[model samples]
Target: MGSNLYDKVHIRHLKKLGDLVPDVHKAHQGFAEAVMKDGVLSVKEKELIAVAVAHSTECPFCIDSHTKGAKKAGASLEELAEAVYVTASIEAGGAFAHSANMHNALDEAADDALYRRSSMEHMKKLRQHAPEPFDAMMRFFQTATAEGKLSVKLKELIAVAVAHTTECPYCIDIHSKAARKAGASDAELAEAILVTAYLRSGGAWAHMALMIQAYGEE
Candidate 1:
């Protein structure tokens, strides 16, 4: 944010955005380093890909930054425009793909109305102060995830790294507990953290080769 781009009006608009936007300021350092080091693509393509990924992430700040980056990296206006469109399309597709998950959870939630009523009855006296409806909502999720259709263990492990990468504390807490419940070893969790760190570090160096190749052309 101390950089020049954040000075621009468009970017300022994004920084002032509400809670829905992912924290780009936190993500930028890792993002800048990650792809350049580990990505096999050119800077131009990488920026464009970042542009598309920004859309999927629903981060307006990221979108603005990557759109600028793509243009600077030699992506044409049309290319950047099309990348946004493609991003939207893929996100819309994901909505459909994820609907089954929603339906599965919803059905499970409703399937045990008697159980829900009983739980509420039990809760009225247990703790004068109790957790809100969130736990009740999560019961449906626990039930649905327990079914063999979704491997809760594997999914929890995957979700933890993704949550940390995305900087969601709630997600990190929830998924880490889930991973432990699923019997994931502390070593595996530590390994996952290292993997994210490695990816973040490698991204920057990977692009240094571009500077080398450019110099070689002389």
Candidate 2:
């Protein structure tokens, strides 16, 4: 009704529908609480994962909410910043990783194959031409995923979650190995992925409140 349509106040509209769908509303709330509680990963760790996945989802509501949650859960500003860059690296990495597809497409004798590990060799050309930016990205990714306040193991785990969300096989392959190398057990990686699943689903669930407001207005 004003200059902008999506203000924080719009979230309250979900309560107006509570009586109509009490069970569904309550289930969503319960699931959110259950997933966010400390498990194998602490709440602080979970919130950081949420922040990373939130960036991949590009859900402003999620980014805002989880950044606040991460801070409240005792994630420092540096930790939060590092988490965001991890997300960025994976997101951009998705694009770079998929360049293998283009390589396959360009080769006259490339066969019908759409993907192969050998296709990644095409990336070497970037080192020849776009050396500066390519090297800079590599530096940033290394720095971001390196151990600081957050361990390399944790950051690699977060990268795995984002790789799943992005559906990038290259990133998954690279980070999974990196995660394991950094001492992330299979169980810890599994738990991080479950947290990712929660945040991905939760992004859609959180936006339903906005959908309700929009529909009511129409």
Candidate 3:
């Protein structure tokens, strides 16, 4: 193995995993194929979602693999870039949206509940507290999500996928509604969520290589 932690060669260890556990490996492969094959969303669309979710998961192997898959599926550079920006916006937006919790924590009268859907209304207080940064984040989010190279529907779908990977309920709720409004079908939304689910698992699966390396060293 290379001295670097995540060399491309490390992925080869996946074969060893398959050799060790053929049934589970084969099942995983089947599930991946079922989720990724064309249905409500095209293979290209699924790849784009995979790319965004891979970034959200911060999986080096997934980022590398799904990017290539996206390209092979005829995703343009512009489309892929837009998908990445969607991931960036959702990640940043999750933090921005969660500032409501901070406001609640600072309030002496606030209830003990850590996460109230109603507390999301407190997000408005951020603009009053820091107008400039708040406006900037909003502007960046608007730019990232607005239709350009990718359609609004596609961008919203990507946002939904990344939100699932980020495990942000606020993002998932917001983007899922946005996705529906943008004309995404329930089936399409379901596929996007599945893509996120697959990639998140694949991240851990990929990191098994690191575990194998550690065990070998010991």
Candidate 4:
């Protein structure tokens, strides 16, 4: 194999891991299968969630795998595009939401707390500071979360999954509640969380091939 860091062939090394760590590798495979199995959410929905999380986690292998999985499960290109936009909006929204901390630091706010719920109140200040871009971002976010090819419930579920990968508490709190309001059950929410967990770990699992290759170099 060539020295390319992210060649498709590199992923073939994942199979060798079974010989080196049979028990843990087997358990990881089992967990991945169990998480992606149909349950409260359909296979198509789970795959869509995986697609969104693969983007959030920036895992090329997971992105390629889940994007194909999503298509095979019957997701249309438009639906997959919407899932990617959902990931984009959430990733951007995390930074936008954190601007409150910037505002706090500027004011030398005495709370000394990093992420108070009340900090969100300062979001308006961003609007006041840069009305054009701030408003544009808000419009994009609204359109991203709004009903389209994907239902709001599914979009919100995707948002919750992406939020976990982003580790954005504000997005998690907001979207979890929005998901419930859109008629997602606790079971569904838990499944979405599990999908996020699997994909996050799956990223590392997929990258194991890179580490193995590096170790083999003379």
Candidate 5:
């Protein structure tokens, strides 16, 4: 599946929403607007993380675009390389560190909860300042659902998995209930999540393969 995520552009966290659907530019914008408030991590660091994620997930568009974005956010070529190297290091590190069937399960679960809550808070804050992000959000939703051939349920599940992984509890609760009510069962929902997880892991494997081949040069 990671082999299929062929994005070549890199966007900030907000840009991820836009990248997923591409029609509702504001869906991307709203998300970006909300998350920008945190100001905890430097913009460069955030963009760097996004780029690393794109690399892991095989989002070529994200990788290319975020490489540009990262530069704009103060990431140097060396820094970007280092960041991806970190991604590589962590991934390569994982290849040998296989431990539990549920790798970092407790931490992952807690991360999910945190993501849901935090995203909700961010959205809430964004709306308070912007005052009309909903209309744009709706438009983004409609375009993605109608044009992308993405099911409403699939969208909800996508939201759920991303929210969970990103630790946005508000989004998790909202999307999870929506997904289940829309007919995604426990198994279906879990499958969606595992799909997300597998893709993440498999993405690293792709990089590992690359590194293995490169190092084989000698």
Candidate 6:
């Protein structure tokens, strides 16, 4: 198939990945299966996390695949939408959260410590800089994360997982606290983290197809 950088994914290349590394492919499949199994969280919940992490990786393949998985696992479109937005918020939050570093760097007299809770205050500057969009995002985040079909606790748990994958300390702090307040146990939190681990790894596994195209068969 003739394709360029912006073309929709040509899935034929994906099948070739199985041929490229049969063992690794098989193991990855098995790991994905095992990871999604019901444990502290249900498979429906796991699929939601998959969808969320897929957004973080910016992998269209994983996003579509796991959105279907979430639907099949009994997730409503509303629930799926919430999960995707949780991802959006966390990924967006990563950039917003890391702005603390920018704030610190700007202060010539600031301490060597780049990330301080106090620096989060600098986010208020957005209200002055981009009032409309910043306020809109905050409102959207509140709506996306509020109690709904998935429950605040469950949403917070998913947020925690996405935050970890994105490595946003502010998001991690905010959502972990929310998760705990919503009665998420340490065990449940751990399971969510594991789901994030699998989904993050699954992204690389899914992209082996691109590698197969790059390294054509012998």
Candidate 1 residues lying further than 4 Å off, grouped into runs, are 1-31, 37-39, 105-218
Name the candidate that leads on lDDT.
4
Over 142-201, each residue of candidate 5 has an lDDT whose tens digit, in order, gives: 443231333455445555555444543444566678778776778656655554454354
Question: lDDT per model, in order?
Answer: 0.48, 0.85, 0.91, 0.93, 0.48, 0.83
| Candidate ranking (lDDT, best to worst) | 4, 3, 2, 6, 5, 1
Model 3 agreement with the true structure over 124-218: per-residue lDDT tens digits: 88899799999999999999999998999999999999988888888888999999999999999999999988998899999998888877773
Predicted structure 3, TM vs. truth: 0.96
State which candidate has the highest TM-score.
4
Q: Which ten residues in a row have the lowest lDDT in candidate 1?
A: 117-126
Please, what are the lDDT tens digits per residue for candidate 1 over residues 23-124? 743475465465433233355655655555555455455566667877778778866655554444333333323333444445555453332323333323
Clashes of each: 9, 0, 0, 0, 23, 0
User: What does candidate 1 score on TM?
Assistant: 0.36
* lDDT of candidate 6 over 63-110, digit per residue (tens): 878999998999999888888888888887788777778777887899
Give me the runs in candidate 2 sitting further than 4 Å from their true place: 16-18
| Clashes, model 3 | 0
The TM-scores of all predictions, comma-separated, are: 0.36, 0.91, 0.96, 0.97, 0.42, 0.86
User: Residue 129, candidate 2: how far off, in angstroms?
Assistant: 2.6
TM-score of 4: 0.97
lDDT of 3 at 142: 97
lDDT of prediction 2: 0.85
**How many clashes (backbone atoms < 3 Å, residues ≥3 apart in a chain or on different chains) does model 2 have?**
0
Runs of candidate 5 with Cα error greater than 4 angstroms are 1-56, 59-122, 132-134, 142-148, 165-167
By the lDDT metric, which is better: model 1 or model 4? 4
Model 3: residues >4 Å from true position, as ranges?
Answer: none
Alpha-carbon RMSD, each predicted model: 16.0, 1.8, 1.3, 1.0, 18.8, 2.7
